[model samples]
Structures are given as structure tokens and as C-alpha cells.
Target: MRPNIVLFGDSITEQSFRYGGWGASLADAYSRKADVLVRGYGGYNTRWALFLLHHLFPLDSKKPPVATTIFFGANDAALLGRTSERQHVPIEEYKENLGKIVNHLKECSPTMLIVLITPPPIDEEGRMEYARATYGEKAMTSPERTNEVAGVYARGCVELARELDLRSINLWSKMQETDGWQKKYLSDGLHLTPEGNAVVFREVARVFCEAWLSAAEMPYDFPHHSEIDGKNPEKAFQQKCL
Candidate 1:
């Protein structure tokens, strides 16, 4: 059976299978060589995610994923006692939760490769302004999530990855390296635009190539359909496939 590459995260991950998304890109790249599973829970924080992990993952996995990307923090970074407080988790707790996740995955499958993904930077001004436009000033309860706060969580993510000796992708920092990255990368201030997805796809592909799969060395399951002899399909498949 093909190995699995799991995508576990929040809204961004939930939408990752959409057109021009990172999940789709991975699936396309792996094709017949592996399976890509997207397990993104929208509006969920680390605390909630921890509860769900038990159900989705076997403690003693008979089939561990070849790789899994844990992308969260966007919802967890929500301001305390604010509009998004329901999803808010303290930075300390967020850090601990991340560690717990890593440990749990490791315990289940020691050899499973894990990638911790920091949430992509949010467009604070753009998000706030959009909220005001939709809900009006009075209806706008709070600046639930801000770029400044997200930066803190992002840092924590990277630092924790180092401490645990796991691979990581700091989308928060990477997205900011470019000018007007907010406008190009973020769609609704939090979710990724197509351009943002492309950015992520490139990074994921890089990791897969550098660490997991060697593109040039790996072969497809069978010969290309075009190469099959139309007059003798089964014979062609038998000879070429083997």
C-alpha cells in the first residue's frame, strides 16, 4: 500500500484541497506513489485539536504516515476575552499543546516524519477594516487576531520545533520577507489566497524532495498511458509495469 502524507491543521488546512492549494499540489506531485490526507478543522484551536487527535490517530499505529504537517496557531492566537476568545489559547498553552501533539505522534509512530507549520501572517488592518465594513463599528466586538500577536505564536512554533528537533515551516516569517505580502498572500486576512497557497506548495515540495522523496530517483507505479501499446494493453502493462 502507498504511504500516507497527512495534512493536519485548521481552516487554512481545511481549505488546502481547494483549487491552487498546497494539499492539491502534494497530491498531484505524489500521484500514485503516496496518499495525501487533509485533516483541517476550521475555527479550532490547539486545545480542541488535542481532543480530536485521539479519534483520528491510533496510539499504536499499524500504518504510520510517512509525513504529517501540523499547521495551527491562527485560531489559537485569538485575543483573550475577545470576539474570538472561544478559540483563543494562551501562548504557554499553545506551546505545550504543540509539544503534546508532537510527542503523541512520535509515541504512535516513532519513524513518522513531522513538520510543524506556523500560521501564515494575518493582515490586521485589512481584517479589521473588513470586519467594520461587514458588521459596522458597533458590531465589531474586538480585534480578535492581529499580526503582532500572531508573530509571538509563530516564534514559539519555530522555537519549539528546534527544541524538539523536528522540521518546521515558518510561514509567518516567510510571508513577511516580501513587500506587500499581506495583500498578495492573505485572502480574508487569515486564510491563504491562491498566491499564498503557491508559496506553501513550493515549500512543501521542497521539504518532500529534500527530506522525504527524491523526485528523480522515485518512479511512477506504472508506465505512462501514452507509452502503452493500444493493440496489446494487458501485455504491455505486464511487461512495462514489472
Candidate 2:
């Protein structure tokens, strides 16, 4: 049976299969060996995610995900009292929500591996421009999110990983350490550019490889009917897997 790899999160994840995004990269890397499922909801946060988590991710799927990555917090870190309160989740609750999700997944699938991703940094200036253009200058003062504000959530994610003894990738910190990170990685201070996506794909691939070395190198199931002897296609396919 084919293993499943799940990408779960908000808009960033929703766009993960975009041109050079991580989903596509992972799909290409794990072709045939596993099914890469992307279930990203745009503009979602931890609260909304928890409310709908069970509905979105059924525990009883016959082919449960072998690996799952939870990449949220970008929206959860939205300014608390601003108009963006809809997406805002307190840091403590965010931690609780993440732990609950992890526990739920473990309960459902003991063998499933979990990886948590800290939200990437946001460039306030770029976000300000985006807000002005999108919401009009008079409607908004500052963009609802900032790198400093989001860092709290990122820290919570990192801490949870340690507490749970799970691998947590610090995308937030990693992006900022690079030169010109704001321009190179984020398109409008919030979302990932092609370069940012590549980084995510690489890091995720690295984690997956370390966790499941054999699975990472599984051979592609190939040599279809045209290549196989018409009378011996079944045997040929079996040999390929072996």
C-alpha cells in the first residue's frame, strides 16, 4: 500500500504547490512511493484549524498519512486588538492547540511521523504597501502582522517541539539570518516567493530523509504496459518493486 504525506496549514500551505513550492517538490521527490496530500485552508489560524481538524483529517482513513507537517502561526500572530482579530490567537492557546493536534494525530496513527514548521518572518514595510494597495490607505494604519509579533508564536512552536520531542523546523529564524531575506524570500512580507519555497522544500526533504531513510529512496513504480511484455506485465511489475 502507498504511504501518505500530508501538508496541513493556511494560505502558505494552500499555495505550496505553486510554481516552485514545496508541495510540488515533494510530489516529484516522492512520486509513486507515497501520495502527497495538500490540505491548506487560506486565511486560517489555530482556532479555526482545531475546530475543523477532525473533519478535515479523518482518523480512520485506510491509508493514513505516514508523515504530516503542521505549518501554521502566520495568521495566528495577527494583531490582537486590530481589525485582524479574526485570525489572532493568543500565544498560550496556540501552544495548547498545537499540542492537542499532535496528540490527536498520535492517537489516531501511532506510526505517523510529525513535523512542525515555525512561520516565516514578515517584512512590515512590504506588508504595509500590500495593505495600502489592497485595503486602501485610509482603511488601514499598519499591517496586522510583524516579524517581532510573530516571533512569539514561532518560539511557542519551537518550544512545543522540544517538549514533545518532535522535530521542529525554525523557518522564521532561518529566513531572517540570510542577507536581504525580506526581498528574496517573501513576496509581500507575508507569503513565500519561489526561493522561499525551495528552502522549505529542501528543509522538509532533509527532515523526511533523516526520519525515514529507506522510504526516501524508494524506487519509482514504473515500466508500464508498453515497456513490459504483454503476456508478462504482472511479473515484470513485481520484479520492478523487488
Candidate 3:
């Protein structure tokens, strides 16, 4: 039987409009060993996710998923400097919210793996320019002026996860390593494009597959497809369609 994975994140993960999200790609990549559940919402932060977790995740006797991979930080990192209740959650609150999520998930399913993902870095000029074109200069100014402010919050997530002993994927650094990663993977300087979704899916897949193999104490052998031993460019491209 295939293991089940729940993708819990923000706009980047929910952006199916840009060509579907990584969850779809993951479904295809792990067709033989796992299934994916996409529970992403745009403009949502970790705090909101924690608030909605009870409704979104019911880890009762219904055979809860085997793992939950969390990808947040985009919306949380948005420092619009607005007074609106939703504009942003204070950094301290953000930490508390994550703590709640980690503690809750650990108790609900002691055996289920929980993976936290750092937010990807945004292209300052590019995103701001796009925002200006879409929402006018007023909205773009904040994004343009700030440099790596959100990245700080993303880094905080890494620290928070480590303190809590949660498994985490450093998306911030990963995105930086890829050539033109932002341009190719991002639909808007802030949201992920189809290509970007593929990148995320591949990384998640590799980690998941490796974890599964490790737990089973067996070597991974794709005799028919020697190209994918937890890494391959074609696999990322192929996952885009799923």
C-alpha cells in the first residue's frame, strides 16, 4: 500500500493556476509508493494554518496520513506595513503558532513524519515591478525597498524547526542554488510557476522516497529507470504535468 503525504503550505503550494502545484507533481512521481494531499491556501501564513488545522486535519482513527510536509513563509513574510488584521502576524506569534503546530502534530500522530519548509527568496526588483504593474506603485514600494526582510523570517522558521526537532527543507537556499530558479519557477516574483512547482516536487519526492527506503531498510532500485536515484532534472520536468 502507498503511504499518504499531506502538503500543508501557503500560496506557492496552492498555486495550481500557474500550472498546478507541486502536490500534483508529487502524486505522479510517487504513483507506485505514495499519494499526496494538497491543502495549500494562498495568502495564508503559519498562524492561519494552525488555526485551521483542526478543521483541515483530522488525525483520528480514520488512518491519518503518514506524513505532513509544511511549506509556509511567503505571505507571512509580506511586510506590507498595513494595519489590516491579516497583513501580518507578529514574529513572536509566528513562533508560537509553529510551536503549537509541531506539538499538536507530534501528539496526534506520533509516528507520522513532519517536515517544515523554509520560504523561497523573492526577487526584489522583479516582484516589486510586477506588483506595481498589477496593483500600482503604492503596493510595489514596500516590496522594492525591503531587502531580504522576509528572508529573515524564513531563516527564523529554520531555527524554530531545529529547536523543536522537526525535519525541515531549506527552500531559501535551494532556490538560490538553481540557475534562474526564480525566473523559471516563479509565476509572479512571489508565487511559483509550473516549472518552480516541479522543482519543489522533485526535492520533496527525493526526501520522501529516501525516508521510505530507509525505514524499510531496503535499497532503492529503479531498474527500469536508472536516471532517478533521488535526483534528476528530467524527473522535475516530468512532474510538472502531474
Candidate 4:
């Protein structure tokens, strides 16, 4: 079977299969080399995601994914007392939950490549506008997330990655490096725009290529069509095994 890469996260990941999304870009990039699977859950935080580890990456599974991305914290960073407080997970617990997730995946396969992605910066104005547009009179007066608080979560995610010696993308920092990122990268203060997705895809592809999963180096699951003789097409596939 072709090796698979799993994108495990929250709504950003759940919507990653959408047109022009980062996950879809990865799928296209790794086409014919490895399968890219999405395991995203909308509105989920690390605390809630902890419950899914056992089922998503069964420890006893013989064919564990070769690589997996753990991208949470956006929802976890939701401000307390706000409309999204229900999704808030204390900072310390968020880190702990992430640690648990990484440990679980490690137990499943010590060599599996694990990449952690920090929450992106939040745009209060954009969030407020989105809330108002979506909820009207029910919208909260203040944004449910703030860039400052999201930065705290982002820092925690990076520090945790360092402590665990795993790869990570500091998206919060990266996106902000570019001026006007609020509108350029984010569509709803939190979620990514097409440009934002491009940034993710570029970073992820670079990391995967550096970590020995370069599409150029990976072998296709089936022989190239050029190898098949029209007169005896079966010959080309005779020795191939799934």
C-alpha cells in the first residue's frame, strides 16, 4: 500500500480538502507518491481531540501513517467569557493535551514524522465583522479571539515542539511577518484565505521534502504508463504488488 500522510486538526484541517486549500494542495503535490488523508473536526480543541487519538491512530495498527500534522490551538485560544468560551482550554492544559497527543502518536510509531502547527494570528475587527454578519443581534460585543491571546497559544505550541524535539510551523509569527496579513491571509479573522492556504502548503511542502518525503524521491505505487508495452500491458504490472 502507498504510504499515507494524515492531517489531523480542527476546522482548518476539516476544510482543507476544499478547492485551493492547503490539504488539497498537498494531495496534488504528492499525487502518485503517497496518499494524503484528512482527519479534521470542526470546533475541536486539543482537549477534545485527545479523545480521538485511540481511534485515529490505533496503536496496534500495522500500517500507521508515515507522517501526521497536529494543528490545534485556534479554538483552544478562544477568549474566556466570550461567545466562544465554550471552546477555551486553559493554556497549560492545552500544552499538556498536545503533549499527550504527540506521545500517543510516538507510541504508535517512533519514526513517524510529526509536525505541529501553531494557531495563526487573529483579527479582532474581522472576527467582529464576521460575528455580526453571521449572528446579527446574537453576536457578542467583542471578538471571541484576539491576536494577543492567540500569540500566547502560538508560543506555547512552539515551546512544546522544542521540548519534544519535533518539527513545528509558527504560523502566528510567519503570517504576521507580512504586512496586511489580516486581510491577505485570513478570511474570518481565524480561518485561512486562499493565500493563507498557499502559505501553509508552501511551508508544509518544504518541511516534508526536507524530511525525506520529497515527491521526487518517493516511488509511485504503480509503474509509469511508459513502462507498459501496448502489446502486453500486463507485463508491466506482473511484478507489482499492492
Candidate 5:
């Protein structure tokens, strides 16, 4: 069976199959090598996501993914008393919840590679503009998230990954290294633009390659068409174990 690479997280992950999304890019990158599965929940925080582990990564499953990316924290970092406070999760709890998730995944398969991805920085102005455009007079005056708070969560995610000895992508820091990232990376101050998705794709691909899942190195599922003799196609088909 082909190996599976699961992408687990929030809206960013849910929308990853969209045009030019990071998840879609991964699917293309790992084509014929591994199955890139999406297990994303939009607007979900770690607190809520924790409950889904048993169902999503069941211990009894005959096939477990070779790798999984845990990409959350954006919604959890939502500031208290803001319009999105309903989704807010305290930083401490967020870290603990992530720990539980990682632990569960580890229990599912000790060898499964786990990658923690820090949330992206927020663009407050962009968020406000989005809120105004989407909600009009009903929109809240203040932004629901801030870059500073997102940084705190990102730091926590990185630290947790370090403590657990897993690979992590510090998206919060990486994006800001480029000037004008607010407009270039973020589409609605929270969601990612195609460029932002490219950044994610590049980082994830690098990690996957490092983990020995390089697309160029992995074998395809079936025999190549070129290997089949048109006059005697059954010969090639019978040679493959599948």
C-alpha cells in the first residue's frame, strides 16, 4: 500500500485543497509516492481538536500515515473579548492540548513522523478590512487577533516541538522575515494567500525530504507504462507484486 501523509489542523488545512493551496501542492508533490490525506476542521482550536484524535487516528487502524502535520493555533490565539473570543484558547491550555494530541498520535504509531507548524502572523488592518467588508455595520470595531499574540502561540508550538524532539516550522517568524508580509501572505488577515501557501508548501516539502520521503527517491505504486511491452503487456503486469 502507498504510504499516507496526513494534514491535520484548522481552516488553513480545510482550505488547502483550494486552488494554489499548500495541501494541494503537497498532493501534487507526493503524487505516485504517498497519499496526502486531509483531516482538517475549520475554526477548531486545540481544545476541540483533542477530542477527535481517537476517531481520526484510531489505534486499531490497519494503515497509519507515515507522517502528519499538526497546523493549528491561529484560532486559539484569538484575543479575549474580541469578536472571535468564542474560539479563544489560553496559551497554556493550547500548549497542553497540543501535547495531548502529539501523545495520542505517538501512541497510534511510534514511528509516525510528527511535524508541528506554528500559526502565521496576523494582519490586524487586513482583518479589520475583512470584517468590515463581510459584516458591514455589524462588524466589531477591534480586530479579533493580533500578531503579537500569535507569536506567543507560535513560540509555544516551537518550544513544544523542541521538547518533544519533533520537527517544526516557525511560520510566524519565517513570513515576517519578508517585508510587506501582511498583504502578501495573508488574504483576510488570517487566511493564507497563494504566496503564503507556497511558503508552507516549500517548508513542508523540505521537512518531508529530510525525513526520507523525497518524491524523487520514492518508488511509484505500479510499474511504469514504459516498462510494459505493448505486444506482451501481461508480462510487466505479472512481474509487479500488486
Candidate 6:
């Protein structure tokens, strides 16, 4: 029987399918190996996902899934106008929301492996422009905060993954290594375009395949380890592990 895998996340996750996003690519890549399901929802935060899990994905013995991947922390950083009742949630609260998701999912399947991906960074130039255009006065007042808000939430996600002992895909660092990723991969500073989704989809596939192969005591293909070299336990272990 094919294993069931669920791709769960926020806008980036949502975009994966809409504009030829990674989720669609992943479902294609894993079609022969597993049953992949893309459950992407735009404009959601970690807290929102937790709520959705209870409402949309409650424990159902009749439809058990083998794996789930969570990619949140984008909108969790959204700011309210100074006059609004709810300001951007603090980073600590973001962490708490992540913990709650992890804890509840664990109750459903204690041994189910969960993968958490860190949100990619936004282009500073794009962000500054957004602030200037949307909140002209407020942007001038808190330009620094406006620029650094996403980083705060992204780091919070990284720390949360560490605390939970979950595997994390560091898209934030990976995106930095590429040139013009904002223009190339994303439709906007926040939402990924089709090409951008392809990059992320391949990455998640690599991690998922690695994790699955590791669990099954199977060797990873290609550069992850030498194909023709003698068995090297240390190198194999390192290659398979994050």
C-alpha cells in the first residue's frame, strides 16, 4: 500500500498548487511512491493551522495518513494598525502556537513524523516599498520594525522546531544563497510564483525522500552518498540525517 503524506502550510504552501506550486510538483513526484495530498491554505498562521486541524483534520480512523509536513510562520507576523485591538502576535506566542500544533498532532499519532519548514525571508527592498506604500506615516515611524518583522517570526519557527525535536527545512538560508529569488521565485515578496514553488517542492521532496529512506534502512541516491564507494556508516548516517 502507498503511504499517505499530507503537505500542510500557509500562503507559500497554498501557492504551491495555485501557480504550479511545489505542492503540485510534490504530488506528481511522489505519485508512484506514495499518496501525496496538498492541503495548502493562504493567509494562515500557525495558530490558524492549529484551529484548522481540529476542524478539518480531526482524528479519523477511517482515513489515517502516514505523514504530515507543516510550513507556517508567514502571516503570524502580520501587524495591526496601531489603533487596532490585536497587534502582531509576539514571537513567543508564535512559538506557543507551534507547540500546540505539534502536541495535538502527536496525540493523533505519537510516532507520526512531522516536518517543519522555516519561512523564507522577504526582500528588504520589497518590504520597505510595501511599508512606504501601505502605511506611509506608520512606516516612517517604525521603519526598522517593519523591515525586521518577518525575520523575527522565521527565527521563532526555527527555535520552535529545535525545541520540538522536529526536522526543519531551512528555506530561509537557502533563499538567501540564490540571486533575485524574490523576483524569480515569488509573485510578490510574500507569495511564491510557480518557479519559486518548484524550488521549494524539490527541497521538500528531497527531505521527505531522505527521511523515508532512512526509516526504511535504504541508501539515498547520488551525491548524498557515493554510489560506488564502500559502505561508510558515518557518512551514510550524516547524509541521511539533517
Each candidate's lDDT (Cα)?
Answer: 0.87, 0.87, 0.69, 0.94, 0.94, 0.68
Judge candidate 6 against the unseen true structure and give its global Cα lDDT, from 0 to 1.
Answer: 0.68
Over the stretch 109-189, how does candidate 5's per-residue lDDT look in tens digits? 999999999999999999999999999999989999999999999999999999999999999999999999999999999
CA lDDT for candidate 4:
0.94
Tens digits of per-residue lDDT for model 3 on 1-242? 45677888787767643455677776665555566777888778877788787776665646667888888776776665542236476667777787787777776688888888878878777776787788774563445313276677777888998998777777777787888876876656766777777767767766766666232343222323545446565674464333
Our model 6 lands, by Cα RMSD against the true structure, at: 9.5
After superposition, candidate 2 runs with Cα above 4 Å error: 213-216, 223-235
Higher-TM-score candidate of 1 and 2: 1
Q: Please identify model 1 stretches exceeding 4 Å from their true place.
A: 239-242
Q: In model 6, which range of ten residues has the least summed lDDT?
A: 213-222
What value of lDDT does candidate 5 attain over all alpha carbons? 0.94
- Between candidates 4 and 6, the TM-score winner: 4
lDDT by residue (1-242, candidate 6, tens digit) is 55677878876766666758677777766655566777778777776677688754576544556778888776666666543114256678888987888777787777677888877766656656666788886663432223267677777787888988887787777776788886786554666767777778777777766766232343223233343346655665555453
Write model 4 residue lDDT over 1-242, tens digit each, in one string.
78889999999999998878999999999999899999999999999999999999999999999999999999999989998999999999999999999999999999999999999899999999998999999988999999999999999999999999999999999999999999999999899999999999999998888887788888878899889899998888986653
Task: Give the poorly placed runs of model 4, Cα more than 4 Å off.
Answer: 239-242
Model 3 misplaced regions, further than 4 Å: 16-20, 80-85, 136-139, 144-147, 213-242
TM-score of 2: 0.92
C-alpha-based local distance difference test score of model 3: 0.69
| True-structure lDDT of candidate 1 | 0.87
Best by TM-score: 5
- How many pairs of residues collide in model 1? 0
